[model samples]
Target: MVTVTAAVTEASSELIARARAGDDEAFQALTEPYRRELHVYCYRMLGSVQDAEDALQETMLAAWQGLAAFEQRASLRTWLYRIATNRCLNTRRTAARRPATQWSVPGVEPPEPTRLGEVAWLEPYPDSLLDEAADAPPGPEARYEQSESVSLAFVTALQLLPPRQVAVLVLRDVLGFPAREVAAMLDATVESVNSALKRARAALRRRPPRAQHEPAPPAGSAAEDAIVAKFVNAYESADLDALVALLTDDVFISMPPMPFEYEGLSAARDFCALFLGTGREYVLVPTRANGQPAFGLYLRADGVCRATSLLAITLAGNRVCALSRFDGSVLPRFGLPQSLPDGP
Candidate 1:
């Protein structure tokens, strides 16, 4: 529950001193509280789970090695962010040059998308990790809730901004850092930070609306439970009508790394044609992702259900507006088994 601005407790003051003096255990204790949030920040910047982990490790090592040069002036939290955010920026610059492929299933024919999504490289942030960091309630100045900041739409919009603008916006608005302090973090003038913030805010306004402002319906609400029931029935029964009933008119479906997107019911129906044509009964293992309801889909063949994709859905009035199907490689990241026992 530690936030960036919590008054440094007396005990931590001691740890900080020892950590500065090259005490490894003291440094570990000193930085441990901020790990999860930093991990999320890096993920926001880099759009990859594995890269975020690597960034976190590099940030910590840099923080520890550079601790001796620390000026006690800045909050330890802000200093850690200085290292973490820059680490993310550096990693992203390299990744942007050499992007990886978006994974698709072997047997399932991915429908041709109407158009490509802007943040086609985007990935979901696991809520389980967010639970681990459960940040102390941010102060009023913080514009977005911790959970909202990681919403699939919000994060995807972020991937579209310039790196410096992303840094400014996340720091100044999302994290509620003051302009002066954020400028210090970005090594820019206050005026420059303010200007970037203005542009970033406008750019985001033009992107998708922040639809998921609420924490996803608490883990087993009757409403969510019913929705899950309908989804399972549709997939297992291969009832196209049942499936179509659950989607919104402007439904959006995207698979990252693949970049193809299906929009509107007509296109979506074309996309789901694969599900119907595959002739494989789907088994959906209920799960969660990015503070939204999700399912790990397994395709059944020869009495075995193998993992195919991890699908996260965004709901509107009981209909789905967005359906993000990630490569099954992300299954383990959400703590879901890659494969399930067949015949439920």
Candidate 2:
């Protein structure tokens, strides 16, 4: 890793020099490597993939315009973050806070939610994007693993923090930057940075656990395959008992853009009873989301299969624990078709 880092730095130094000398291609080269991680970081701060990409584009443009003034006091990564953080902060200041996801299904009434979830505007991050970003080693000061930080629950908890605190916590804890460096990026003193992180940590602690301790097996591991197969079998068969049997006792369910939250096996059963009880069969197209097992669910009705739902499942001790259900609005991001043939 050290050797690779040195080579990258060497390459970036050359590009930086050429870019400062007015080479557009060199400037692009200098900024490209940082884009994805920056995007993930922005996503973490803003809780929206689209928002993150927009901020990243703006950050690149800002970096380009400011390249001439680059003192190189901080690594390019840190400098880019400074710009992106400010951009997100500005965005949050003007944009209305995201509302909880609403239940939009017609005719099928879900059981009354036992409690309202705080992060209704939460969205799932694609595991494919994490392919490169999460695998990169967390910086020395980073307390949380990169992949772990992007968990829906963690990102949701992050959205609840003040934007500045969000930046501070991500920089200090997720990226592993020291307080002094985060202080520099945020244009604040170390003390202020530390203070913000402290508050953020306390607030995060008050939220429900976003994940269990069991290590998520590799994306296509046998264990993951088994659990996913079980889900598909139970769901497609519309066997409520078999379906409920697959869930852990404390299983959690949330549909983003809606505030409703259901927990435990009984609530899971209620959800299954409504979504699967339709006499028509459902089809499960295997997929991935937020580094967890996910599926694109479709229902066979009216001679065609149409999008019914998307589920991102969290695991604990080999049993499904947290099941995050998303409305069809998310299907496009996963490259899932809106409809499919009822036949295999």
TM-score of each: 0.91, 0.92
lDDT tens digits, residue span 6-62, model 1? 555667788989988878999989888899988887887777778889999999999
Which candidate has the highest lDDT of all? Answer: 2
lDDT of 1 at 224: 76
Which 10 consecutive residues of model 1 have the lowest summed lDDT? 209-218
Candidate RMSDs in Å, in order, are: 3.3, 2.5
Tens-place lDDT per residue, model 2, 1-344, is: 99999998888888999998889999987777878888888889888887888888999988999998888888887788889889888877788776765578777887989798877686777777877563346678788875578888788788788888998988888888878888888889999998999999898888766445567666678888887788789988988898788888888888887788899888878887987786768888887888788888888888899997788888665678888888777888888999998774
Q: What is the lDDT of candidate 2?
A: 0.82
C-alpha lDDT (0 to 100) for residue 14 of candidate 1: 87
Task: Look at candidate 1 and tell me the lDDT of residue 26.
Answer: 98
Counting clashing residue pairs in each candidate, in order, gives 1, 8
